[model samples]
Target chain A: MDVDRLHRRRRRWKERLMTVLIYLSVLVALLPLFSILIYVAIKGIGALNWDFFVRLPGPVGDPHAGMANAIVGTLELLLVAAAVGLPIGILAGIYLAEFGGHGLFSNSVRFLADVLSGVPSIVIGIFAYALMVLPVKHFSGWSGGVALGIMMIPVVTRTTEELIRMVPRSLREAGLALGVPRWRVTVSIVLRTAAGGLTTGAMLALARVAGETAPLLFTAFGNRYWHRSLNEPVAALTLQIYQYAISAFEDWQRQAWGAAFVLIIMVLILNILARLGTRSKFSTQQE
Target chain B: MSSSATGIPGQGHHPPAGRTGSGGTGEQPGGPLAAGGLQFSSRPRRGLADALFKAVTGAFASLILVLVLLLVLELVRSSWPSLKAFGWRFLVTQTWDPVRQQFGALPFIFGTVVSSLLALILSVPVSLGIAIYLAEMAPHWLRGPVSFLVELLAAIPSVIYGLWGIFVLVPLVRQLEVFLGTYLGFIPLFSGPPYGIGMLAAGIILAIMITPTIAAVSRDVILAVPNSQREASLALGATRWETIRNVVLEYAQSGIIGAIILGLGRALGETMAVTMVIGNRPEISASLFSFATSLTSVIANEFNESGGALHISALVELGLVLFLVTIVLNSLARFLVWQVQQRNGGAARV
Candidate 1:
């Protein structure tokens, strides 16, 4: 009886110990994230100024240089990528969700999308280089946009498909019963309903590709000066950060932190907005 | 409603039969010959439109498949020159001199594997602990916020991680290495002089980068374990920890393995973070404190300055290697996750 009592006490102690360990583990897991964010904020805030947003980068040793060209170039690349990727991704998603008949073809498309998403971003850069840069014999904003666009496709397609699939089958059936063409029903009824979720998905994908530096390295081939055409090499936030961080100069390193701060802020805002969008839409649907 | 009058047979359009029959036979039989002629012409056009829509959407859907195939084919084609030049020796030889036009993939491959595995080893325990805490232990109110914070880790860009690694992690790791070297210097792995930026820093940063993925997936997997399993174990006189160890983790082992593999895939292909801290030395070393280079990092570091066809081809070949490794790992992860879902009798709600 005494031994049984002792064993019970030991087991209880062990369980309590394990519980403490679990909580500590959570702290340990989250330590890096909080540390990085706080440290970056501290370092980055010191470098920000009005000129940081407006003035172009000066020469290597020049002080008070800003990444204005890179900021504009990043937006242009994102614009082109969105224009190219969104329609294709949404249409393909529509096919998978609406017209897909659970056949081998649709299955293959889904599988390939997953595979493509898993492919290294640098590999996509290489692909863009071979496909676009090789043909044109130049690394241009177009190639960078195409590389990022390809990276965006799988995420956008899968998210759009999942969101569309979540729309009740009854909605589709009702449209069909109304004597509407299937395509018309999909476009007017189904897609309209899923637009909020689709937009959230696209924003998430955009957030992801915005920070991709490896792909743009070979494709955009970063320019120091402001580029005005898609045919010209483009400056990008990630590329600028990478270049500045790697350079020996302390000022460039500080600018790299500034760029990182901007990039992270943009990404976190997009992520939060997407989550809020999804939450509100889902809550409304539940109601 | 009158539009049902033009319903064509065998076109898969399910216009209501009552409306179609009444409208077509009774009303439109001999009334308004022009209207009847217009309806007849529009039927074929509507059928054509349906076919056309299906064909176009199907074509767009197939583009993903086409793109994947094209990627593989293009990588193979571009790397063919290097593949043909070095043949099998390209993968085994350690030399990589652009001046001598000698190239090999062994060192980079070794570095990639070692660093990724090191990350996996360091991260899996913490991730599992967090997963268990979130899935089985955390109270309802805490679960949502904690998981959100974890996921935010994933949302941060890789380059940002690299930036942090350079300024923050590398210095800390350098100090840690000094302490380890003093205490564990007899071990070959801890013998080298700590450079502050090497395989160890790269691996630690990678661990931080991939922790979210593994933790999130493992949490989902653990949550998917039925409540009955826990109840049964508790009823059998098992402690809570025992139940989690023997019942929860045992059941979700495959999924956790899958999560680890997925994280491994991410680590292997990680470019910016690893490159920023890895010191970019293209040599194999016995100590974790020594500099190393990965396949993706080498390509990113060199593709811009690569002068000739041979140099570019060699870099492409490295990419091909990284591509193949990630693809295999990712496919395996997918299969494992699918198996877990099948075992759960539905999606895991992740």
Candidate 2:
């Protein structure tokens, strides 16, 4: 009995030690994130102003000038990307989950999609640059959206497929039993049951593309003035931050922090929304 | 936003089908058997409209696949100009002087493989420990928050990581380099110029960046092991640690290795962070503290400024190399996961 007691105590001690190490690991993970956030928030608070939101980025050295153009450009590109990519992504998701099975073509498509998921965003940018920017003789925000749309598709498709697959097959069969066509059963039954998940996935993908800088560096090529043209070079918060942060100027560097803060905040909000979207419906279903 | 809301409502305005369908009679189309012939009859489709809808849906699905194929093809074609010009020598030669239109990728390739391997070597043990803690030892209440924080690390953009590495981690690494040189200078790896931004620093930052991917996937794999194995080990009078060491880790070994490979792939493709911390030196080095340039970092830093035929081709070649590395890593990971699934299936059969 005493030996068992000692063994139990030893196990408890080991467990406790492991728990402490786990917490410490979590703390270490938070260190970089917290440091960056705190630094950005502290430096950026002073620059937060309405003028900063409405004016163009100043010359390479200036910090007081606003990031209006970047702000507008990011939103425009994200909107355009969603417009182009979402329906296609969701539909592909539908096909993969609902229509796809053991067919050779479907398997090939699935393999290609997985490969696309692993390809770096910068390569996607390079491809867009070679295909669109080079041929068009100039950079354009449309191509930026195109690059982002490409990145978003695999992510959206994967999530959408997973969610749609979670819907019961009986529902699909019931729709078909009502003399509804296969397409109708897919559209109305499977997709509707999976709507919450699809939305969450699409939003997460949008959030991801919104923060992308690599593709934009080559595709949209950064704008300083608000031209409101997708054909023209457009300044985005990420690109602005990238270009400014790299320059040998402190004032511009401070503004980069400001932009980082803004981008981080935007990502945070989108994440919260995505979490909420995924969680609320998911929990109800679990119950 | 409103237009999107309107457009999406059209997609979403369907009946609650899945849950309700399950409750319905097995033979009936829907519950309560509105079995009148009129109820069972199909409404005549507005034939052309229905046809158009089907075509549109099919087109949309095909478009994503088409886009993916086009991307791969475009990469191949764009890479060809340089691959053909340089031949296999592109991977061997290290001279990257663009002024003379001479370019090579040996340094970049070396840096990428070395730094990525270093990251994997450094991170795998620490992350495995963390995963074991989370999967086996953590209180249920602490698990979700810890997992969420790890996931949030992934959400932090690579650029933010770059900035933090420059402003915060680099100085710390520089201090540590001085200390390491003081104590370990006899070792060739520690006998370098004490520039903080070197291969070692980049590797360490990458280790930190890739840890979450390793830890998260590993935790999931460990948790998937059946409780029966644990009980069986306990029944043999084994300690908990023994049970975990002999049973849990054994079951999760393949998946854990897969997770590490996934993390390695992320480290390999990491661009902005390595760019900011790697000193941008396009030189091959044997010492860990020497400055170097990774393939992705070189492309990210120099691609825009790289004018002329050879310069551009060289950068594209680096991208191709990174792409191939990631493809192999992902395939390895997928294969491992498949094996784990198969093992679990075979166990069930036994």
Identify the leading candidate in terms of TM-score.
1
The residue pairs that clash in candidate 1, if any, are none
Give candidate 2 misplaced runs (Cα > 4 Å).
A1-23, A60-63, B1-55, B345-350
Q: Model 1, clash count? A: 0
DockQ scores of the candidates: 0.49, 0.34
* Predicted candidate 1 versus true structure: per-residue lDDT over A146-264, tens digit per residue: 99999888877777676776676667656655556556767898789898988888888888888899999988988888897989999999999998888898989999999988888
| TM-score for predicted model 1 compared with the true structure | 0.92
Off by over 4 Å in 1: B1-42, B347-350
* TM-score of every candidate relative to the true structure: 0.92, 0.88
lDDT of 1 by residue, B1-350 (tens): 00000100011112221111112111221222324333433445555666677678778899998999999999999999999999999999999988888999999999999999999999999899999998898999998799889888888888888888988888999999999999998999998998889999999998988888788877877877888889999999999999999999999899789879988998999999999999999999999999999998999999989978898999999999889988899889867855664676644433
Residue A121 shift from truth in candidate 2, angstroms: 1.0
**What are the per-residue Cα lDDT tens digits for candidate 2 across A1-287?**
99989988898888567656656776676677677778878876765677678888888655469898999899999988898778777877666555455367556666666677778778888888988898987999999988888888777776776677678666666665666655566677878888887888788788777877887878988988985689999889988887777778888877878888888888878877987887797797776
Give residue A17's lDDT in candidate 1 (0 to 100): 93
**Highest-lDDT candidate:** 1
